[model samples]
Target chain A: MRITIIGSGNVATHLAAAFKNGGHRIVQVYSREIQNAALLAYHVKAEAIDRLQDIDPETDLFVIAVKDDAIFSLGLSLAPYKKLTVHTSGATALTVLSSIMPNSGVLYPLQTLSKNKEVDFLNVPLCIEGPDEQTTRILEQLAQTISNKVYRINSAQRKVLHLAAVFACNFPNYLYEVARRLLDKQNIDFELIRPLILETAQKVQENLPVEVQTGPAVRNDENTMKMHLQMLQDEPGLQMIYELLSQGIIKNTKDGH
Target chain B: MRITIIGSGNVATHLAAAFKNGGHRIVQVYSREIQNAALLAYHVKAEAIDRLQDIDPETDLFVIAVKDDAIFSLGLSLAPYKKLTVHTSGATALTVLSSIMPNSGVLYPLQTLSKNKEVDFLNVPLCIEGPDEQTTRILEQLAQTISNKVYRINSAQRKVLHLAAVFACNFPNYLYEVARRLLDKQNIDFELIRPLILETAQKVQENLPVEVQTGPAVRNDENTMKMHLQMLQDEPGLQMIYELLSQGIIKNTKDGH
Candidate 1:
């Protein structure tokens, strides 16, 4: 299959490589910055284009692997190549490109992609949604060439999953930064807690988060919690976060009971 | 060493087994309920004692593994057996047992221990703090028997590590629960997001979280965030959390610049 990728971000770089390596032709790569497009195009052996008017008309699929905000605007400009066009966004729905392209679909990879880090695309979960079953099947076939885990998720569920991903991925990483900062103030190496972080994630692999929950919050140890609050009295934002999350954990336990 | 362990909870259970496996004599296991003590004692080849009066005086090391609130009261009761005493708590300070026993110290295993799961104690970081040099050395030797990664951390530093740990382990696990609940509402299986959770944790093992942070907040994508906020309007608590954390991510980026 011939493909024209319409972004130069992390998702675009990875998906383009995966598709190219999976025996597909990368006809062209487009970006607002010509140098960025040229850099990605050089690696994928595709022509680089900064303007949408110069996109290949004969490409089999147009993958708009750009930001959620840019998808609609880019779709409006690529009206000529609307056939089987797909956007790789977890939040945006197929309706965003509905009027521009009836054959539009979604192919959201449920993984954190970094362009510098080579991700094993085979293990990444590819979530595909389309206006029709035929479009879904074609996107699934394209996804399967690079990944083993593929699922048909609708727009609503995909948006919810994206929200959950923020909690599971983005929020936790921020909390880790919070932890790192806390350790830094006390001259403690963040390395000491690395094993604990790894083990916490590993525990949830076979068990539910509720079953594996452990801490001062779960134990209802008011003394240590008070001490911790006193320790963070100066930093009100952290204090609020600490208080809110503790309350959430306590409330969840009560709800379970 | 003849070790008498108090409290039959998760920490006590794992520590008892580790000590027994590490060639220490299990003198006794104590709990408010005799059955709980006996259950753990049965596994470690130790006698079970419910009352504080029945504690063996000949034990070389006394380990108090009870809840934070109970530790001080339990220490008062165990005044007769205060020789080389240690409490396995993260947020607790050495002064809690200072007047009750001058030979008191701490042996906090910085990992989420569960009674059912077998942890590789060799890798678990044992944070020890003693009242004096000789006491610290003795506690360090005992800690070395069960784990390779043992650090002689002071009370202030240990408490900081404890606080950091709450952010790293406890808060992250709770965030995972939040994600699970979000997925549950949509009838989406939590298993789908497992890989993302694992990969997110894995990325932090080798890289600083600030370097690897990703999401709508980090990207500052207002469209998707606004959509998420509207979707979460019904749950005010989650909405507040989303706002606070997003602001935190954005603030961190600005601070970085």
Candidate 2:
């Protein structure tokens, strides 16, 4: 399969490498900055192009791994090519690509990606969506080559999944940052909480988060919760978050959901 | 060292096993429920007693591993023994024990413990605080026998650490529950986000949480954030949490802290 990757960011770099390693020919790499395109193109042994006009029209697949807002414009630019196009975004709808190209799909990898960190694509869950059965099947085949888990999720479902990902992956990380700041004020090393964080995440794999939930909030220990709120008295932002989340937990526990 | 564990809860059970494994004699285990105490004592080859009067006064160290509110009363009850006493609590101050017993200290483990799970005490950070230099030294020696990471954190510092932990461990798990509920509504398996959660946590181990923070909140992507808010309209509690946390992230990122 011939592939043309449209972007030079983390997702683009990782997808390009995974495709190249999976025995697919990366025909071209496109980025506004030629240097960025060339860096990823060089690794995949593909041609690097700065403009959308230079994209290989004959490529079997065009993966737009750019930012969420950039996808629609990029799709508009590549509409005339009528190539099989997909965007690696969890938030964007498949219509964003299908409205531009007859053959459109989604190949959203449900994992955090970083340029320096090597991702095990085999373990990453690829959420695929397409307008037609054939388009979905083709994308699924390609996704299965790289990932073990492939789901044919529609645009609406994908959006909800993306929102959940924000809660699961994004919000918790922000909580971690808050934790780091709180520890920093006391001159305590953040490493002390690393084990706890890892174990908390690991628990969710085997047990439901609600069933395994523990802490002052779940236990309804008013004294501890009051003390924690007092500790964050100066930081209104953190205090609000702490209070709301505790209330949410208590309500959820009572509701038994 | 002769030790008496004055509770049979999660922390008490784990601590008793770890101390016994470290070659210390667990002289007795005490609990209001004799069955609970016997369950833990049986594992450590020690006697289980429900009454405080049955507590071995000759024991070198008495560990009060009960609820936060119960610690004070327990300390007062054990004060007549005049033996070294410590409580396994993070939120409670070290003075709570010292005010009751002359030989009071803290052996608060910084990791979450469960009865079913086998804890690697070697990696658990044991926060030790005592009234005097000798008491501190003795607690440190016992802590070193079972764990590699030991800190002489003061009561105030430990309180802050405990607060930070609520954010790091407890709040994040609550966020995960939020994610799970969102996915449940869409009939999406929560397993899909497990990889993302694990990787998000793994990043914090090697990098500062601030440096590695990602998502619409960190990027200040208003479109995605607005869409997520709309999706969560039915869940007002979750929606408020989402808005406040996103605002917090944007402010923190802009402040460059």
Clashes of each: 0, 0
* Winner by lDDT: 1
CA lDDT, candidate 2, residue B152: 95
TM-score of chain B of 2: 0.97
RMSD of 1: 1.7
Q: Report the lDDT tens digits of candidate 1 across residue range B47-83.
A: 9999988988999888999998889998888777657
Clashes of 2: 0
lDDT of 2 by residue, B1-257 (tens): 99999999889998999899899999999999999999998999999999988777778988999999999999999888888889999999999989767899999999877777677889889999999899999999989988999989999999999998889988999999989888998899898889888888888888877777778887788999999999888889889999998998898899997
In candidate 1, stretches whose alpha carbon ends up further than 4 angstroms from where it belongs are: none
Per-prediction TM-score of chain B? 0.96, 0.97
Q: What does candidate 1's lDDT look like per residue over A41-127, in tens digits?
A: 999999999987888798888899998888999988776655678899999988998767788889999998877667788889999
Q: Kindly report the docking quality category of candidate 2.
A: high
Q: CA lDDT of each candidate? A: 0.90, 0.89
